[model samples]
Target: MNIIRNPKDVLSGLLFIALALLFGWQTADLPMGTAVRMGPGYFPLVLSGLLGLLGIIVVFNGLRTPGEMPTGIAWRALIIITFSVVFFGFAVRPLGFLPALGVAVFVSTLGSRLFRLQTALIITAVMVVFAWAVFIKGLGLPLPLLGPWLGGY
Candidate 1:
């Protein structure tokens, strides 16, 4: 009797479509130039279109086939990861990019059952170094390694 055979896929497809529409709407004001002379909005609009197309396909497929519902959620991991993100957002200005990112990455790793302090430390170090290389040195973002709280300019 249910028209939607796969409820999860249908819901996810709808979510994707909604996101695509929202992004497309936001990008509408920006000028989209020709392919050869691409504008700031060009790539985003193209991506949004692709996302919408994909969502349509997913919805059709879901309606055509049956699928089991998703298993129980990973509440612990979800909570920890969410907390880490919020902490990073709040701490970034005071702690600076490197320290905030490092702490966030490390704390996020603890959300996993296979968490190891040594591994988390290594990941934190690598992520901090990579972020510094990409955002600071390569792209020349004006983020400080340390903030005013830590005597950095």
Candidate 2:
């Protein structure tokens, strides 16, 4: 019989379960009407249930298997990605789509070990164009193409 005592694994499993539950609860507000055409809630609800199930499996596996250790959390990458999201949210309205998206892409790439200045710039530019083409031209999301300097109003 294996005696499991990995605090990190237990905590992570619990956290995943909690997050899944939270997502499920929040998604409840979305309409889940017909089976033929699933409402917004359907996808999130299903995904959350799957996540919670996975969390349970993780916890059970940890309990059954001893000597299992959790990997170290990448705090720097986490912080950078988080801040990038925040930057995207704040900059989207004021700085407009292109600039905001560029910054977001660049900041997000910082999390990767292979990130370089030139690569980041290239990726940012490509992503910006892609966003403009897809969201603005294709979907007509009305995202501003130019920055405030050009008086995009």
Candidate 3:
């Protein structure tokens, strides 16, 4: 029996619900103080509850409306994106934050068939600078812009 009229909404709702549950479970041990003097768990629990409520609404909406059939996931795109993230995790220390970020963004762009080298380069440069500012300048995280090999040490 076809239970879902909109597969995308149903799947998205389920994901949100799962995340909410996980978040709630993780915060269960933390003390939940009052709204005025909120504890560490307060915000996460409230957000998770709201997310769960939204998920229920979306699931009901999906069940009530007709939608397109579920399409196959783009495996190539998924793999490329995942690899890019993993690569960045490993590359950050050796390659430095800027280079690692550049490679990650560039590799992720390749996940799309419309990837253009020039566009990727431009995007990489912009994102690198943005990340540098946010992580290094704004937040003052001590991420090396250039690694030891590049004299960033």
Model 1: per-residue Cα lDDT at residue 29: 94
Taken over the whole model, the C-alpha lDDT of each candidate is 0.90, 0.83, 0.90
Instruction: Please list the residue runs of candidate 1 whose C-alpha ends up more than 4 Å from where it truly belongs after superposition.
Output: 1-69
- The TM-score values for the models, in the order shown, are 0.63, 0.59, 0.66
For model 3, what is the error of residue 57's alpha carbon versus the real structure, in angstroms, after optimal superposition? 9.1
True-vs-predicted CA distance for residue 99, candidate 1, Å: 0.3
The C-alpha stretches of model 2 lying farther than 4 A from their native spots are 1-24, 31-70, 147-150
Candidate 3 matches the true fold with a TM-score of: 0.66
Backbone clash numbers for all candidates listed:
0, 0, 0
lDDT of each residue in 12-59, candidate 3, tens digit only: 788889999999999999999998787889989999999999999988
lDDT-sorted candidate list, best first:
1, 3, 2
**Candidate 1: worst-modelled 10 consecutive residues by lDDT:** 67-76
Superposed Cα deviation of residue 32, candidate 2 (Å) = 7.0
